[model samples]
Target: MIITRAKEYCIKILSSSNCKKLPFHNLSHTQEVVEHAALIAKETSIDSEETEPIIIAAWFHDTGHSKTYFGHEEVSKELANEYLTSVGYDTKKIKIVLSCIDATKMPQHPSNLHAKVLCDADLFHIGTELFFCKKLLLRREWELEKIKTYSDKEWHKINLAFLEKHKFKTDYGQTVLEDMKLKNLEKVKTILSFY
Candidate 1:
């Protein structure tokens, strides 16, 4: 299937020298996004054709992090366009995939259902048990890149504020994930209180 092919392409690119330092935006993260996108799509009753672009976007969303961290979403979009075109994916579907990737950008504001699903999938970990673990990896990635650093207490505060400001766009996300996310926010607050 095209999704499978796109996943393989993503894996291959991530394994190449170009993606040597991606502690957070690695293959594992991409796989997680793909799985979350599928779960969200299934829960939302999105059609198979619609799910295809979501999955493809999930695979390629961070592929540009292989080359650079700054403005990687645009690079991801370009790469997705190039790879999808080369593989003969339908033009309409490619556009959908691109929009999905775009929706994953920071301060995400998705314009359509596929983009909404992708946005929720990309940030799904904020509502899961693995949230802190994934967050630690992201922190480590940032430190390694000399982006920024934070103490445990500071990180807890930052996460709490982020959770407070963020909201899931999809019905499944709002109904299923929001509670967990709120619980996580409280957990972070509890940690901060101890500090």
Candidate 2:
């Protein structure tokens, strides 16, 4: 199907990139998001039509990281638009994919189920067993990119605030991930105690 083609295209594009600068948002991260998106979509029982754009959006979501460090979502849209249009993807559907990608921008505001799924999938790590591991990678990437640097204590405080502020949008996320995220938050707090 076209979704498979889109996957191949995205894989090729990402593989061809010199992704050394992208410690976190690289192919591994993209693949995780795609898998999470697909799993979330399936658990929600969304039909293929909905799943298509969600999967497509997942694959292309972080592709902009190959181009720029910040505001990559817009470049993601341009790349998705160019590729989808070349493949003669339905305009309405392409819009859906782009919107899904946009939904992942921080302080994410996802209006639709597809966008919600994509957003949750994009951040699936926050609720997983590896939040700290992922967090370390993200922190390193941020330092490498000169976005910001924080001592472990400072970072833990910031992470605690973030975990407190963040909420999962999807019902599956709220039900399945929320508990783990809360657990992670408490763990963060516990770690901060030593600092």
Highest TM-score against the true fold, candidate: 2
Off by over 4 Å in 1: 18-20
Residue-wise C-alpha lDDT for candidate 2, range 1-195, written one tens digit per residue: 988899998887777774445778888888999999999999889987889999999999988877887999998999999999998999999989999999999989998999999999999999989999999999999999899999889999989999999999998899999999999999999998897
How many clashes (backbone N, Cα, C below 3 Å) per candidate? 0, 0
Indicate the residue-level lDDT of 56 in model 1: 93
- Full-model lDDT for every candidate: 0.90, 0.91
Clashing pairs in 1: none
Which candidate tops lDDT? 2
Off by over 4 Å in 2: 18-20
**Pairing residues by index, what is the TM-score of model 1?**
0.96
lDDT of 2 at 187: 98
